[model samples]
Target: MAAVTWSRARCWCPSLLQVFRLPVAKLYLGRPTMRASQQDFENAMNQVKLLKKDPGNEVKLRLYALYKQATEGPCNMPKPGVFDFVNKAKWDAWNALGSLPKETARQNYVDLVSSLSSSSEASSQGKRGADEKAQESKGILVTSEDGITKITFNRPTKKNAITFQMYQDIILALKNASTDNTVIAVFTGTGDYYCSGNDLTNFTSATGGIEEAASKGAVVLREFVNSFIDFPKPLVAVVNGPAVGISVTLLGLFDAVYASDRATFHTPFSHLGQSPEACSSYTFPKMMGSAKAAEMLLFGKKLTAREAWAQGLVTEVFPESTFETEVWTRLKTYAKLPPNAMRISKELIRKNEKEKLHAVNAEECTTLQAQWLSEECINAIMSFVSRKPKL
Candidate 1:
């Protein structure tokens, strides 16, 4: 059998689980590479179905897309029309794979299920931690009105730097908006700056030893980026001022990105002695071409709003005085449209990248977590914190 045929056969067969200890990938030359155990994949799939709360539309579509792609190879059906929201979303998600082979899709499915299962279990064990409560007072401010959900980074005194709890809050807010049928779009912004990536103080102050803190911090950040990857609704970012670190990378995931005339964006991963986050490794190159992505990630080039717009990284730029009003007006226009239609359209646009993004996120997190423990990262953080003024 051809490699694709064999992979599809194994994916569809349950009895094969009894014979093989794990899923196997056959090389073009006929050698088998060990992958996840069949039992492991099945268990992850089952856990997904058993989870109490819905994983929201994007995740549901992702699961369906991955399952179909793994079992049936690339989509062979005709694309659905625009008005057929349900089938269109499903079709687009599956068809986005184009001609992706079966084994790769299976591996992607396995990775997604494992991540979701872990997240669900963690939620079930706790309602909300102290960190969440501590930050509830002022970190992330969420307000919804007239179909618009606005999530603002409110820690301006600290240049809108995000803490672990703030990350969790933002993820929850986004997930909540995804389920709220009335919520047509989500707008993220900040007072003086978009965000300063993360608060290094929070990371260093984490309890236990340095290694434990780094590991736990990496886990939290991974969950945050994964949530962004699966955000279902139209995410719109209003870059009111400067954005740094993950904040800059995350703009690639937004469906619409508007910026103030004074807005600036930069990712200091290379300068910080850390790897990229938020799957920017893939999304950036796709959005701005490989040459530009290399400059941003490798050289830490900062771009003004106009520069970003010219480079196709931003949708538009407006004066600081009118930026919020203009962005809200645009969001309201989208909110007035058919919610299902809007969601399906966004999904279709993002569907092709779904699996590849998850894979990249997994790889990035592993490397990032290791980097977090490195002497270079430790010294960098120490110097930044002890310096006269923060970076």
Candidate 2:
């Protein structure tokens, strides 16, 4: 029998499976038959609905294939057309099981569901513990209202500098907002500064050497930015004050950016001996000219609100005194629009470039991983921490 090519199936499918991979077990011959009753399969199906979190795309696909095999015996239906992306993926997944017996498929399905439930319970406990601490710290705040979900960076004293936990928090928040009944999502920061960017301590506090630390950080950073790129709903950035580093770099991925007149945008990658990330290398030049993008990314030039607006980086600028009121009012009205219409329209607009963005994000993160391991980057980070500069 032919083995399943899961990697190819995952790449073609525009689904959650792209986030992570799950191991596939090889099929063995002369295995003892394990009979699974219909009631057992039914129970497993119900259990899946009660899962606290999604089992991710790969697992879901496996479950789907197994379920189909159990119910229908085999994938006898004709394959879907290429343009039928969803059905094509579903067909491919189910067909990969080949001629596995229904009883075997049923048994596998039950086993998978049981494993998922047990793991889910353990994961929930750990998540609750981490969430409790995050709540107490109030480092990141997430709230939904009037069809709009808001994710706020709350560490004003630290200029909302992002920590590893904050990165995870934001990624989770964005993931939740993407599937929730929200028409739009907005990013903002509390207090005077929008965001001071990554906490240098994130690097300094690494338990492993630079190479290992850089690898791990790169993985997290890639997922963080991927969350933004794959968000289905409209994403808006409210630049309340000075925005630096990744915060500024990521604005290029937002559907719209509203900045206060006092707000500033800066990406000082070279100063830190690092390369541009968040796909800014692609987005920056595309938004403005290469020379201008070079000035900000390569030479550490910062832009005022008006300057950013002129460069096509910002949607609009509001007076500092009335920024919040103005931005909120507009967003509330925007939220009143038909949610599905907005989402589908956004998807249509992004379809052509979505693949490109993902490719660019991967390339940027890989490059950044190397830069993070460089001696110059380590020295710059150490020096910055030693000075204890006010973020």
Most accurate candidate by TM-score: 2
Query: Model 2, 197-277: lDDT tens per residue?
Result: 998888888888677778888999988998888787889999999999999999999999999999999988888899999
**Candidate 2 vs. true structure, TM-score:** 0.71
Q: Model 1 clash pairs?
A: none
What TM-score do all the candidates reach, one by one? 0.69, 0.71
Query: What shift in Å separates residue 148 of candidate 2 from its native position after superposition?
Result: 1.4
**Runs in model 1 with CA error above 4 Å?**
1-137, 388-390
Candidate 1 residue-wise lDDT, 226-333, digit = tens: 777777667888788898898888888788788899888888787677888888888888788999999899898999999899888899999988877987887788
Pick by lDDT: which candidate is best?
A: 2
User: What are the lDDT figures for the candidates, one per model?
Assistant: 0.70, 0.79
Report the CA-based lDDT of candidate 2 relative to the real structure: 0.79
